[model samples]
Target: MNRLTLVHLTFLSVGKPPAAVEFSPGLTVIYGASDTGKSYIEESVDYMLGASELKSIPEDEGYSSILLGLRVDDGRTLTLCRALGSDTIEVFSGDLRDVPTQPAEATLKYRHHPKSKSNISRYLLNVMGIDGRRILQNSRGDVVPLNFRDLARLAIVNDTRMADKRSPVLGSWMPQNETKEKSVFKLLLSGQEEPVRPTAPSNLQKQVGKGKIDLIDQLLDETRERLSVEANQTQLRDQLGRLQATLANATAAAGQVAAERSAVVRRRRELEAADADTQQRASEVQQLLSRFDLLRQQYESDLARLQMVGEAGTILGYFQTGTCVFCGAEPQHQHPGHRLGESTQLAAAVAAETRKTTELHHDLISMIEDLESQAASLHEDHARHTEQLEGNDQELQTLDQRLEPLNTDTAELLETRSRLERELALHAQIDQLEDLKASLSAAPPAPPVAKADGIPAADIADFEQVMSQTLEAWQVPGDNRVTYDPTTAELAVDGRPRKSRGRGMRSVIHAAFAVSLARRNQARGFIHPGFVVLDSPVLTYRRPEDNKEEDELLAYDVVKNFYSDLLDNSAGQVIVIENGTPPKSVRDRAAVYAFSVDGSTRQGFFPPLDSSW
Candidate 1:
């Protein structure tokens, strides 16, 4: 089987300054302090392999792009460059310097896409001598094209996962992915791919129908909670009809009351307008009467004064004095300036004033009488209008009293009608759900069977034996014999659960399990990517947990013997990332890189701050 191996991983700054590390074919160890880039090495390798996103770190500040060089077993070199936060990787035929402006081949998609030829997973899988392969995802026999990322968990183990208790075969913590994950692992172990068979259109239609049935079932359950009555569509419709008829009757009765109230209100408005006009007329009549009374008094006073003048003139005429009584002269003796004719002139003037005053007195009396009559008529009209308004107000109060009960009844009817309509709608929904359910039942697709027939029993036994031997070689205490539990997809050591052990023991066992699988693949001619990267595999030595004295010895023995075993067997390539110091025996055999924070040799994975991007 063709296999791929990492040659180098480079982080290029904007100026193309490089922070890179080279790897050998066999065991490679990167041991360093807490904040060093030991774990980042594992992450970068994954990112280059097609991880969705790169972890942002302070050490990554200067890096604008990542370049990974890979060498195939056939001696061909491939370099892939991906800019930060980008999903497209430029592929080159050979390793080159300074980010290439154009790739030699078409760009590869970072994530797998349906029906895409340029996805990185397909590219990498093709290079690994596997193509056109499909894995059974579910048992209605749905198969999906193999994806590299699903297999990456087995190839690369990160630090936090070192403490996880779930089976390493499980990709995510979600329950739904467990079956697919186990299936993929089994396929890798058995070296067989399920045949691709296209589903018929009828089968697809059945599946879609089933999905709709499920959705309608869920909707019916929700609608059931809101239904006021438990009844079928027929019964509910009958009840709706009755309620609607009742509502119509109630509406008509209420409308009649409303019309009557409206008529009463309109009549009240008309009476109010008439009363206003009558009041205005009464005001004008009162003003006219007041003026007429004043004129009548003036006319009477003038008439009285004129009558006195008339009497004085009559007396003067009866006396008939030819000359002024004081002068005592005859008519001939009266001078032009004398008052002999003054009395006659005064009588005449008085007579003319009296005649004019008498006429005015009669006219004023007549006008005053007419004004008094008009004022009386206005008073009568005002009284009549006031009575009419009072009657209208009483009628309005009666209408209001009648409408109050009608409004309450109508409100209750409307609320009942609305509730009945809602129930009717729910009935319609239930009917729809029933119809969908029946349709689905009539043309049901095969149910998805549980994925139980996992890896072959003989293959599992061989895997168990390999795991047991690997752990025994690592000097892990207790019965090192392991068994793979198909149900849990986890390993059982010494008849005890792997997760039941201490965290440190779990980490050690997890690493052994990973390395053993890779070794077994190479030995048994199984399909594998030919490389595994483990971060913090031997954490027991770093932390004094789970029997310190015993763990220290085991950790030392495992670290010392682990590398020797891999190198001695020419096992698949492995990268072990750890914080604990490496054993002298292992250090001598493995390519080692030690990192620190004090600006010593190999300060960190990043370039100097001033030289960074």
Candidate 2:
């Protein structure tokens, strides 16, 4: 089994001699008065082992760096030096003071990360025979890589930690950490190491998947709404075919309507042209009738003039022998102005003029009759054309009314078909996404591993036995049938819960738990750091407040035997920092360091706090 033992812890000052605490393989104790920096020793050890930051103390003011010396199982010494207020630690081959100008190996970081070679957890965990091990981090059964800081909670116990009621394996009070903490303890007990494989999907991937599912669901809902019906792909395809056939029939019908509309348009245009021609012909016929009437009137006027002249000649010829009636004179003796021409010549002239007038009148009458007949024929033709134009106009109006509804219906059908096709396409996309989601959900799960659920029952039983034996050796009060509760990752003393006991008993039990773990690992070849630093483990014995007399006596006896039992824990290193001194039996067999208020003999872990300030 690989083991890591802390040889010494040294704190170096800027311009003064360094203060150091030494340790041995079996047991080392630093017991002294209060405020003597005993608790600081445990804190410093934890800080060097990758703690986030060291606690501030007045005695630590002048310290420039902290150095921790470790002896690996190979018996080689390695020293790590951390400068004050720095995140990097320098590693040396042997003991260190201040900071090394040139480190023997690469500098290590104070934090842990998977890809970092300088991380302190890797360096410390490697020496402890537990490297590349994983621990469950969350309920998803996802495992995070192992590091020494995770195990530090079990290996280092400060004053508060000793009084804490929670399990030593647990680092915080968060409930999420309960399972993981128990698993870590189980891993230490089992001593099996396994490299972590990051099989769990990343947070981004999970989030994206959820987003995709949501989007697909939303799209599916919208598509169904657009379709106004819920149907499978096959049903949708059938519907599409039906719609296509309907559209095809509708289109053919619309084409016939369009042809009828074109014919109506052409007929209407022809009627308009014919109506215009009819109007022009009617106007020409009316003009011809007006002109003929005027010529007939002129011929009637001429005939009247000729008839008057013929009458005057006839009267003159008849009244040749008679006296004039109006002038009382004979016609032969009348004035030349009033006298008519020779009777014979005048009569002939009148007869000829009358004949000419009569002939002209007849000719005019005949021409007028002919013109009237022609006008009548033209009028008949105009009337017929006018009637035909009106009928054509009525037909055109009717056709326009019929085509309007068909055009509207065709447009509506086309739009509806287009919209349905688009909705079908959207449905196809939604179906694809649903299928993908199903396949992903059916994916095989990761194989079950130890610690994925919790620690094994048999391993817990073995751990409980070791703890019970340790407490029995210490002669602890109450039943020695102690058991490590895997659920709480703590111990149950005499069937009672560990935290239910008093602070005095709790401190003793917590100490026993740490010591037992180190011993158990050393004996069983389990993975451990081979060292445990416990601060004020026996504080309850020295200062038992409000405790019964029997309980107080029990505490005293427990503290005495506790040290003796620890001395026998071979192959394990135990460092106990306390305010109370130990029993002589254990003191004689261990290395003991004492700190006092007086500066003459010992100045505590550092120079005098007053001098340092």
Candidate 3:
């Protein structure tokens, strides 16, 4: 940031307001004894420059406005004003000799209201191009400094917590919170802050930063007390529910089994009744077969006798059988012409007997056929009955197999129902246990707000740039290294950033931060409104003279280098409202624009010390 040279300003004015205070690019001081409107002037600048808050004035100072005669980077002259009530402020670009007034292209307002106190480090932020946390107050007078400062450690305010000093919490580094913000700031400036920070996970997030457990035993005790009864109940309940559902399925299956069993029993009884009919058919078929076999033997005998008679007739016809033609007398049964003798008669009788026997054989054959036909019909009926019996037996076997499982299933179903009921009971018990446990246990606590994105931490980019440039201003060794720790959120040198809690250490750190920023402005031009109107920084000195000399020297070098750097830098203006002398080098190089408290104007007005435009 460029060192400021105040040219003109008026807070409580009568005629037209001192609408402009053209600032110089070099050293500018608005020094005063107690309250010569020095702080008010700073507040005026802040009001015009978009401070979230501003000081309220009495009704006498209507529509507070500031006007300035300014020099451009191109060596041109212009007039600028900040009008509180006007729709737009006026701007003149040319020479003071022939000024032309026109409305400014843009109208900027303070981020804070025009009734709040401004912090010193905030001015530094504005100069380095940072927006310090502008706390908004509530009706109850509670301040919620811009929510961006969740972590207080990130806010480095005064000389008490300089960046160069070793931090106490971190023996070899700065704080983690600050470094994180710094990294973010750097990224934001570079347009890369959006990509950082972990993405939210898909799984249920385990509540972080909850349930206090200061000691290991306390944690164990809490877990044990909370989970013991609930765990057991939950398990039992789950088991019971499962068993009940299983049992329901089993009962349904068993009912189907019982229906099948009834069908099997009815079929078995029918098969037993058909057995007697099958036996009767078998006995009739056997008697007919026996008679047929005896008839077949008798038929064979008759056939043999018929054959013998036929042979005898043929012989008798050929031989004249009147007398004993082969000793044949009258045939035994014939008496004609030597008639058929006893032999012929006996042959006739034998033929008749044979015929009868042949008839009997045929009858036997007919009887056998009838018996066979009857047997076949009965066998068919028996076969049908046997088939029915086999079917019934098979069904019975199947039923027997299913019956056992069916009964078992029915029993299981009952058990399952009981189990389900038990499970429900257990579940209820578990729920009660959980409630009791929760009631007995303390509620989880919220985490402390982390200090990040505020002036101190957010200033990391400015802080680092300033410090690095400061060292460069001092021109330290080429190997002088620097790194920022994200975890501890501190800037580490040679790879370590320690948190400083000691008085000297903190002072040095703060001093380093201021010098670094001041030196950076001295070396490079970066316009930021966070830094401006740094009237005085609040300090907390822990010791009489701890690291005081080192801090002073660091301060001097930084201020001197900043002045030297401002010759070309145009980032923004820094108005250091100081009570002591500045370094010699700073005095020799830059123009001094001061606000003498005992001026003709009681409130002290702006005018160049050398009276040069």
Cα lDDT tens digits, model 3, 14-35, are: 3333323334454454433443
lDDT for each of the candidates?
A: 0.77, 0.73, 0.46
For residues 1-613, could you state the per-residue lDDT of candidate 2 as single tens digits?
5788888889887676677888988899887666667788888888888888887888787778888998888887889888767898878887655466663686889899877667788877766656678777765557666778777888888888787888777778999777577667767877544345445555787788777777777876775676655666677678778877877877787677678767867876776677567567657756776786787687677767767766776676556555654355785777654435455566677678778867877886787677667667766776776777677677767766776776677687777667667767777777786787775666566445334335667777877888888888888766678776565566777888888887767888888888888887778778787788898787643331222223332466777878878876563898898766566677678988867622225757777755532
Worst 10 residues of 2 by lDDT: 544-553
Top of the candidates by TM-score: 2
Mark the regions of model 3 whose C-alpha exceeds 4 Å error after superposition. 1-20, 57-63, 67-184, 188-193, 196-483, 491-534, 537-573, 583-588, 595-613
Ordered by TM-score, highest first, the candidates read: 2, 1, 3
lDDT per residue for candidate 1 within 537-571, as digits (tens), equals: 87633431222223343456776777677678666
Counting clashing residue pairs in each candidate, in order, gives: 0, 0, 84
Candidate 2: pairs in clash:
none
Q: Report the alpha-carbon TM-score of model 2 versus the true structure.
A: 0.61
> Which regions of candidate 1 are displaced past 4 Å?
196-453, 540-554, 597-600, 610-613
TM-score of each: 0.58, 0.61, 0.35
